[model samples]
Target: MNRLKLTLIRGLPGSGKSTLAKTLNAVHLEADMYFINKQGEYQFDPKELKKAHLWCQNQCKYYLSEGQNVVIANTFVKHWEMQAYRKLAKLFNAQFSIKVCTGNFQNSHNVDLLLINKMKKNWQP
Candidate 1:
């Protein structure tokens, strides 16, 4: 397979992006993981988000070059965020697909608020 295959999976904080990524055996890159590693310890500097993005971009390029699939797990709330990755995939001559996870607004809203409160309680900052 010479062409790259990219899968962009988007969902709110508590949805199953990571789970699906793992199940598919795809290269998983999560924004929250950019902040915290497998142990859930915050290891990245606050100023390093941009660097993280580039690193993830490079990783995607590398895996694609190896003809492997990728699953990018992120909130992807804005069109621009997803656009950047789409551009990257295009630059690499890769195929791309976007999967947006959605649910009832009231349920999603409640889940969002509940997650926010939980994060507040546990957030190191």
Candidate 2:
């Protein structure tokens, strides 16, 4: 049996959450990836982000059940969001850790800005 670990990578618009997610070799489930409209504006429809979040949570559960690790690369800007992930981690009997990266820290290649601009340009809802 493999032990599942739920790693939460939280940050603002220009944080390096995606980089960290990739570094961990885990799944990268971010809401912005799902909300690319035709105009390339990365705006989620009303309540669509929540639905995407739920989908990620379900995926996480399935992976954990199969002894895989998951890294949630998203801006969990609210306490409720954190709580929800924690609850899911508990339900899966997996170890959970929260990793917060404030965009203020110095990093390589300014991934946050890149992601922001990419979303602005290519986001197709």
Judging by TM-score against the true structure, name the best candidate: 2
Model 2, span 39-107: residue lDDT tens: 876665656867877777787777777777888877676656778779878988888998876564454
Off by over 4 Å in 1: 37-40, 43-46, 103-125
Please write out the lDDT profile of model 1 over residues 53-78, one tens digit for every residue.
77777777788777787888766655
Tell me each candidate's TM-score.
0.68, 0.69
lDDT of 2: 0.71
**Prediction RMSDs, each to the true structure:** 7.2, 8.0
Q: After superposition, how far is residue 44 of candidate 2 from its true place, in Å?
A: 4.0
Q: What is the clash count for each candidate, in the order shown?
A: 0, 5
